[model samples]
Target chain A: MTPTITAFETSPDRGQGLARDMRVRWSLEEVRQPYEVRLVSFAAMKEPAHLARHPFGQIPTYEEGELVLFESGAIVLHIAQRHAGLLPDDANARARAVAWMFAAVNTIEPPILDLQNAKFQEGDKPWAAERMPLVLDRIRQRAGQLSERLDDADWLDGAFSAGDLMMIGVLRRLRPSGLLDEYPNLAAYVARGEARPAFKRAFDAQLAVFTSRQPAAG
Target chain B: MTPTITAFETSPDRGQGLARDMRVRWSLEEVRQPYEVRLVSFAAMKEPAHLARHPFGQIPTYEEGELVLFESGAIVLHIAQRHAGLLPDDANARARAVAWMFAAVNTIEPPILDLQNAKFQEGDKPWAAERMPLVLDRIRQRAGQLSERLDDADWLDGAFSAGDLMMIGVLRRLRPSGLLDEYPNLAAYVARGEARPAFKRAFDAQLAVFTSRQPAAG
Candidate 1:
């Protein structure tokens, strides 16, 4: 079944591929699944319609017939479970991969989101300076742990699964801060994720959204 | 296989059932699955052995034979997938339930955790008073969105699947702030989860850990 996924009509990230939809796109690309995109504007996102699809009214809601799914982590997992490449064939390995998926969003991503808030959400506030380091510290602690676990491994686990897809997605958001560089192996790890042809295709597809929207040269 | 899980030696919430382990315990109880718990000290959690089980050095890591999994969301999902009662028989419904799991942690809990940081982690800072409203606003925005989506529904999807289990666990954290009371249906929804016999047993079990640790009431 072809799933219909939502994305920002005019993304605030300016097509950095940092949007949650990029993960969904990457997951689909990894599994070689053909899907459809339905873009929604910011104003339309908060309306009852999008909210009906996603309680939080966020983009990247997946609709496949009767099932309406949100949360990029879950959407990717759903796709991975049905498809083969994103998950391992072994039962135990599959559960571990799922653990990495949750770790990426719940454990790893929260501090990253806190970092985003420190910069974008609260950058103008008087506390930005005072609060920024604290946020950065939290990110450093998590990144340090992740770097240690990853060590010299090419992927988080046996092979590239949806777990790496989610983790790299979260880590990519950290590039603007340059914190990812502090841990050389993690920086290399992110580079490895980017090197995947599937990731490049997804990145270019999302980036195209912004490039196409760019005003014509004078 | 009887799985083993981990929890705090003395939970910071004072047996409030706010720890991620509560969700795992609740899930085990719902499936009527017998399990064992191993308590970890804060110092031990950061040590190498526990880090091996959980890179994040947090509680609620699941181990059954060779399969060691961390992240309460992932653990509970693992249990639900392997057992009955916690998930729906319908494949699509199960996927939707998984979406709620991600929503509770990713979309819902981040704002809640920000509120936690504002109060517990950063309450000492000079910006505490001025910056708190921003965190609360973030929480309020998410809670308001959740409330609208729930809209008098008994569960987020249907029939109290793991989705409801996760959402309830996330919402229970808000009780101390009284924000949950603002959303009557959501508050009742949490209450209904608490009233379940399985939830009651899990709550009592975790609460017992704290009670057992307390010094004699002198």
Candidate 2:
């Protein structure tokens, strides 16, 4: 069965593929699986029906037959587990890859999210200016540790499994903050992830959603 | 062979079981697995050897034979997958359970971590007092949503899968904040988890570590 995943009717990221839905879409594309997207407005996302699908009332929920799953990491993992491409055949390597997936969101993404909260959520607050550096420093610290770990590796682990998919997805959010550019190899790593044919397809799919919603430019 | 996991020689939480190691330990206890602990001090955690095992240089790295894993969520999930007791036998149900695990860490814990950053990390900052409400409000929003979803349900989904283990573990962090108390059902939910025999064993084991390190109180 072709799974159906939800996305924003108009993503807050303006379809730059920074939204979490892109992770699910990218995973499906990587596994060469065709799926359907259900676009939801911000208002509709909070409604009871959507909330039942996702307790957090967020988008990018996966539904296949009786199964419904949320959280991009889980959804991607689900895809990876069921399909052959996104995980390794070796058991230990697979577990290590999953560890990187958790690291991307739990360890690395939290500080980056704080940067967003500081800029957009608390931008008007008096402390925002002074606190901005602290937030950036936190991101840099994680990024530095990550860069040191990445070194010259093409991917986080031996292969480009779901771990790289999720890590690159999380790091891509730092593009606007310019923190990613500070690490040359990390920047190259993100560039390499984007260059994947699966990633380009997923990127264009989400980008089309944004482009279609816009009025003619000329 | 017994797997070995790392913990803090002296956890910052001071034996409250708030450290991520508790999650792995609890999961092990639930599965009736015998494991060994290797504690690392703050200085040693950042050393090259520890960093080689865990790139982020944090406690609770799991080493079983040839496999080495970091991130408590991944470690617990690894334990869950290998043992029958932690994950539901049904495939779809297992996937849903994993979704809750991600929700607990990614969606719920980030705000809680932000509160920590605001208080302890920036507690001395000029705007610390004023900025706390915003931090608390973000946590409240997620907690409220979670409470509504949980309602009177004993667990996040069904049965006591790894999902509940992780969600309960994450919610336990809110104890000091008094945030968990605001949601009576959620508090009860956490209490139910703590009352489990497995949870007690894990809690006591970690608590023993703290007490052993302390000089006799006068």
User: Could you list the CA RMSD of all candidates, in the order they appear?
Assistant: 0.9, 0.7
* iRMSD values, candidates in order: 0.7, 0.5
State residue B165's C-alpha deviation in candidate 1, in Å: 0.6
Score candidate 2 by lDDT. Answer: 0.95
**Per-model C-alpha lDDT, please?**
0.92, 0.95
Query: For residues A76-186, could you state the per-residue lDDT of candidate 1 as single tens digits?
Result: 999999888999999999999999999999988999999988888899998889788889999999999999999999999999999999999999999989999999999
In order of the candidates, what TM-score does chain B achieve?
Answer: 0.98, 0.99
List each candidate's DockQ score: 0.90, 0.93
Candidate 2 chain A lowest-lDDT run of ten = A10-19
Where is the poorest 10-residue window by lDDT in model 1 chain A?
A7-16
Clashing pairs in 1: none
Best by DockQ: 2
DockQ of 2: 0.93
Question: How is the predicted docking of candidate 2 categorized under the CAPRI scheme?
Answer: high
lDDT of 2 by residue, A1-218 (tens): 99999999986987788999999999999999999999999999999999999999998899999999999999999999999999999999999999999999999999999998998899999998998999999999899999999999999999899999999999999999888999999999999999999999999999999999999999
